[model samples]
Target chain A: MNHKEETIRVVNLETGYNSKKGATVITRGINASLYSGELTCLLGPNGAGKSTLLKTLTAFLSPIKGEIFIEQKPLREYSDAELSKVIGVVLTEKLSLNNMSVEELVGMGRSPYTGFWGRMNENDRMIVDESITLVGIENLKGRMIQTLSDGERQKVMIAKALAQETPIIFLDEPTAFLDYPSKVEIMQLLQRLAREKGKTVFLSTHDLELALQIADKVWLLDKPHGVTIGTPEDLALNDDMSRYFYREGVEFDRESGLFKISHKLDQAVRLIGEGARYNMVKKALARQGIDVVDADDCDVEIETTDNCYIMNGKEVPSIEMLLDMLNLYCK
Target chain B: MNRKTTMLLMLLLCLSIMAFLILNLLLGTVKIPVKDVIDILLGNDVDNRIWTNIVMKSRLPQSLTAAMAGAGLAVSGLLMQTVFRNPLAGPSVLGISSGASLGVACVVLLSGSIGGVALSKLGVIGEVTITLSAIIGSLIIMGLIAFVAQKVKGNVTLLIMGVMIGYIANAIIGVLKFFSAEEDIRAYVIWGLGSFSRVSGGQTTVFIVLMLILLPIAFFLIKTLNLLLLGDSYARNLGLSIKRARLLVIGCSGVLVAVVTAYCGPIVFLGLAVPHICRGLFHTSNHATILPASLLGGASLALLCNLIARLPGFEGALPVNSVTALVGAPVVMWVLFNKRKNEI
Candidate 1:
């Protein structure tokens, strides 16, 4: 394993857009360090400036205040050509391309390295093949980019970024349009690239559950709080994630590392048993305005065992019947 | 899609351009013998001096003008399509061709009505006035478009702006036609019909020289053009300065359209359809192949159109515009209809 190093260091960064009208700052006083050999995910509500920060760090939008350092040098000092060699990005902008083969599109990633005409030598070709192999989309090299599914397209874009051979990769919602399994696949692929290649991989995503599970570091951006950066485990344990999503009816469950809706316990009943069936039965009861309690109380105690529900010595064959009986008995 | 196949297709396109060029030079109203035409082209003695004169003075310049204008307009179309990332965008999509027509309308229509000058009286001098005015009009629009391209961040916004400008120019021309003398309106209408032979011998050399210089310059942009296929954000992250590339591409396309429309009188359908044809035949949108294919395909199609325009039945010569839309529109419609799912 390669040792982690701070490839990108930010101090008191204020990011936004500058129009002829005036400079409108989006986020203020954001101090963060993005390290190589780790996967960092930025989580925030919509319009919280996650994209603005990413754009500023990648030099798409100039920062309104503070400074950014790439490889211990000032960000402003690096030319656009120099910065392209250092960072690769997969953006959320929908590509409207047609009749272009996958390899040709991926070969375009070599622009920063190739000469003016962008003719790739053998070494560049080998790197492109390796990138496709890494992303496991070798089957798609000959197919047109427009024909590929959304997940396949996302993988192709990632492979394109990988082919650039940069030390840092920034993705804006890389998993936005992917299915659940594909989302997990993309997240794992990014994490593996960061760990194996020692590349600093950073991305902003709305997939909070997936990021909490797979990311090595998480940066939480919200309106009032500028940015809260820590490991996912540390953030969840320190109640940072919970505090970030603090609302009237939503509670961030530290145990599951997920946010759950806090339902009112209007009527409580004793429910017993554990395992998959028990959880399903509990869910069915909870949906019907009945709260499951650990302590024995009131009447109507239901026990689940051997894929069957028993209430007051009456064996219930199915959850539907159990719900029916509970409705009648509770009434 | 492979290199070998692309090379073979490119060679085929070049061969077609040659074959069509020869047919255009060989077949005409005069029906000069193929051997004699070849002899005359080779600078050998020919029995008939008139045949030699017709081939050298008329057909040669006309065919060369059509070929170069076709290639130039096709390349400019490819640039516009890539910059906007819109498949429907063509050389005149920026309203540059309309600007040229407006200039010709002002010079031709206004000349007879206001200055008491008829095209019959002015003759060749009137042609020069019209061409120069077309140049002035289109360059003014090109300059305006290039200026706006730098300030606007959105490609679609620039596209819409160009389209609105074109509409405004056409509206002005409509008003000019309403007030013009009948003879002046007829002259303006003839200019609007478009012809390859309108550019005289000296101007033919100039047009070819200009396109010969400008077309090769587009090759230097193949890399940037390819990156642009990935859309603006990806192109920018690839180290392509999007604004600069936009300005350069819009400038290249605008100048090419301006020159072609000024000389050729807004030749239509060749610029819009040739790139689409190349894409269909090559089955790839990579500019490295599509750009050259469009060039050669355009020249071949234009030569074919010229030959058909001057065929036996047509009196004098059919307008090159009608010939192009007649022969070229179906192939483009078929390519577009088949690829309706992915228009670009």
Candidate 2:
């Protein structure tokens, strides 16, 4: 642990939508400290106010009460240009850039730092190029943004944020529409960004498995109340997980550290082997529903068979043939 | 192009515009060479009084009107497109032009019927009625569109609503046309055909002043517009007052559209087509470049259309709108058909 103080602090924050009547409070009294160089996943079920909280935290919505601080300064105190230098954002909305090339789109990340006319100088170009290379989309630099795939577009967006060179990055459901592999890749990239580059990444996601596997800390947005923030193991051990996710006959298996249906019964499998092959054989035997027993106590003979099954010095290529041989011997 | 190159191109464009204006003044129904045109401009012309009157009064003001109208419509289109984040959005989409047309229709068709006794009693009131009605109609439609824009979240929906409003306004114009007399109908038809020659030297000053007021507002709102391109939430995240910014942009665009409508009688295509052409030419949507580029491009395109309209062989000048449509429609169509598949 770096033992550094928290970089993002939210104290008693209340947020919601506003209407003619008054404010509609979605959730209240959320308190959390997001630390430096940490990958924090905001986890919650659908309609649990995860997005609202993320929006509030990112200053997209004004909190009716309490305060948010970045680097010990009040979030609202910073000008847009000043704040953009400290925090970068990746929104969920899709952008349309018809004539703009990928590099130009990425270059827009430096907007906050650019002059009044928004001209890009040599240093700005270098940063854009480097960010493009960092996101591993250098090959698509010349291509139009509208030509990129969804996953590729997401990466380019991330590259754009990276080009901003902000210390903290906030993403709103970046993996929402990505396939499983792409989702995993994005999570891994985020982890690498936090660990290697010392950047703090805060993202909202419903992908609990990926969050549990990758995040340094998890903030679960429980319904009708505030959020719970801790390590993934801490939340799991405290049994706070069930409150966020509810499905009939489904439960978290503490021992295996995975989710399983409560109605499912375990079918035991036994195998005899010494090292690497032991687990492989166990898995193969588990698929067949046959138990592998110890050699001394087993009634069945064990041998390495090639091209045919040989038991007690008899060769039988087919199961029927082996059964007939056994009946003949018994008679 | 590089910054220097773009700057140089803009300069060349300005120079060419000046040259075209001079040429338009010199060569018209009666042939006056370039030297006589320059000499007339300098107040030292040894020419026929009729020729001087034509050069000084009609041709000069007409050319200036064409340039100003072109620039105004183009800037309005550019601003509308940026604010709405739609390539297809224009001043016409919001029925501002139709509003002007409706005003003209009422003047030509309903004036005699609505205020026959008043017209006979007060002739000045009749002329004032027409201009005021047109200005009021444009303002009313602008107000409606601005209200709708505040309510609507999606750009595409706003665009569709604008088109519907235009259709409804045109329907009202259709009804007015049914009651109009042939002479009145001819006057309205000629206005509908569009003309820069209608603006006198005095009106040109008003046009320039209105543009001067509106262009700065557009420039001042550039930062907010850039934030807006990222969408509302993102803009809010950046601490931009989105509602305020939207109002400012809408107000600016309304003024631009209204001024052009008041003067040029809803000249077509410049507002709808020039912005896209400028965007394509500049290869960037950043308003810093696009705004000025659209202005120059609009000026050039308008001058070209005006020149084509006044080509010597034609018995009378072709409709300015017809010339612009012939040039502009193809370019806009190409943009629509060949647009990249992944654009929103």
User: In model 2, what lDDT does residue A75 have?
Assistant: 86
lDDT score of residue A220 within candidate 1: 97
Off by over 4 Å in 1: A294-298, B110-120, B123-125, B178-180, B339-343
Q: Estimate, for each residue in A152-198, the C-alpha lDDT of model 2 and write its tens digit.
A: 88998898888888888899999989999999988998888887677
- The local lDDT score (0 to 100) that residue A158 gets in candidate 1 is 94
Tens-digit lDDT string for candidate 2 (B163-228): 898899999988877876666666677767888876666666766677677666677766666667
Error of 1 at A6 (Å): 1.0
Worst lDDT run of 10 residues, candidate 1 chain B, spans B335-344
Computed on C-alpha atoms, the DockQ of candidate 1 is 0.71
The number of the candidate with the highest lDDT is: 1
Winning model by DockQ: 1
Error of 1 at A68 (Å): 1.4
Local error of candidate 1 at A317, Å? Answer: 3.8
TM-score of chain B of 2: 0.92
